[model samples]
Target: MVTSARPQFTAFIGQQLLASGPLAEVAIAVMNASRNPAAPPIIMFADASGQPIDLDLRGTERDVVARLPQPAPDREAATEEASTEPRGRGRPKLGVVAREVTLLPRHWEWLGSQPGGASVALRKLVEEARRANGDADRARAARDAAYRFMSVMAGNLAGFEEASRALFADDRRRFVSLIAGWPDDIRDHVVKLAFSDRAEP
Candidate 1:
């Protein structure tokens, strides 16, 4: 069974963390609290990624329940049509889609000269590029996510400037030290998001 990605979110009530978890749970909690005027106005943000989750909670409980995942549609019919016939010449067994790719004359010439023609060469090149840059891409994404969360939550807090500097400098220890005095929930959450994939020195 393929597990779906569960994006974590954190909800806040006037700088204080109210709830943190999957979007559906956080949204529902915020929605319920919104019913009471005396409750602090709630704002929800996605973890590390720093994007705000805008939920329209103006619905009945049953309506909200429907938003959660139900049983996936049965794919038994799709499974049966599996491997009866041989693949055609143009369409390979791997289900390769043919799309138009515009290239300059020299580029086309270079690709056509490669083994197994331009398509195979292009695919190999793309795969090689992806493999080479994969780690750096992921690290950059993590840094951006951490920055987003910090900008929204701790932008005005003390040591924020220093923390931001440490973050961009890739100085993990200094960053942790700078944010040590932050609220327990905020500090912990930020640390988890920022350094979850990083190694301890």
Candidate 2:
């Protein structure tokens, strides 16, 4: 999926890629394509999750764009507002949520002895775990996203099952070989989604 301030989408007519960009542009392309009586079915996909996107392309380009979901609130502005808010009598609002932890006695003792007590210690531990597993997590997400798109677009193609197995096995070479005979656009897009985080070998 796309990683940017604005999400991106891709539209394909059969195995031919029609458009790839921000939602408005893709939606406009789809709208235009739909006008052709002989045009094949158009499928749109959200780049981030590789999920199919159903567009409301019934009206003008302007109407289609207007129907798109609104962008999320500006995070920078929200952070600024939160920082400038007046503090109450209690601890400063650090956006910390209180949740119960069910740890053994020894675990609690160790956390209690940490420099910043249980909460800080727990946060630190969680952060460390995330850092350690970050690459694996990202790779897994990419694999899943690619699989989702492949299931929709290439499920009936030759070697689809083998390609899927190779994908989950993290065998890039095998996956590529398995899908070598598929349509160019579909193969290329699958590779892009499955290995966006990795350098080309």
Candidate 3:
């Protein structure tokens, strides 16, 4: 049931964070609460990558969610198209496309020599690469996402530089130690964003 569409978010009211969780709709609601003239000048909502999410305050909550980026089409569903006609040359019933791939002569020769032809070989190579790099890719993404949140919310805090160093180095202990003095909500949210994808020690 894993889906790339699930969004993660954090909200801030001035320098103090208000909440961190899924659902941009809820984040927008929290941001709205702090929008009065007397409140802090900046009420921001950022995604897991720390990019600011623009919410049109005049719209309904559902409208706000609808404005967020939707997931790409399901590949499996797209490939399942039922057709009565024959597929054309270089076209696949699996929805494959025949794009010109410029490869060195030797590379092309090697691919052509594979059992099922260049296309099948290339697909196998791609699937193997994805399987091999999946974990590393997810870890790198987590680090980047956490760093984004930290830069926006705690860049000026004490030990931020050291904390950042520890974060990139994957030294969880040192990172936690450096940010221990930050406000409870901010510290907790940072830890969650950084480690939410990682398994417990």
TM per model? 0.71, 0.77, 0.75
Worst 10 residues of 1 by lDDT: 74-83
Q: Which of the numbered candidates is closest to the native, going by highest lDDT?
A: 2
Q: How many backbone clashes does candidate 3 have?
A: 0
Residue-wise lDDT of candidate 2 within 17-95, one digit each (tens)? 9999999999999999989999998999987789998978987888899999876555445445555766443233444
Question: Model 3, range 1-201, lDDT digits (tens) per residue?
Answer: 232545656677776766666757555757577557787645454555766665555576766777766644655354344233454575554566767889999999999999878876898899689778877777787788778878877889999999999999999999999999998877887888788777622
Residue 167 of model 3: what lDDT? 95
Of 1 and 2, which scores higher on TM-score? 2
Off by over 4 Å in 3: 1-5, 19-24, 41-47, 74-101
Taking the tens digit of each residue's C-alpha lDDT, what string does model 1 give over 1-201? 334345678888766788888777787888887888988767788774767657667788667756755433333332233234453565443445688999999999999999878976897798689668766665666777888887877788899999988988878899999999987767877777777755421
Q: By descending lDDT, how would the candidates be arranged? A: 2, 1, 3
Name model 2 segments beyond 4 Å from true.
1-5, 71-124
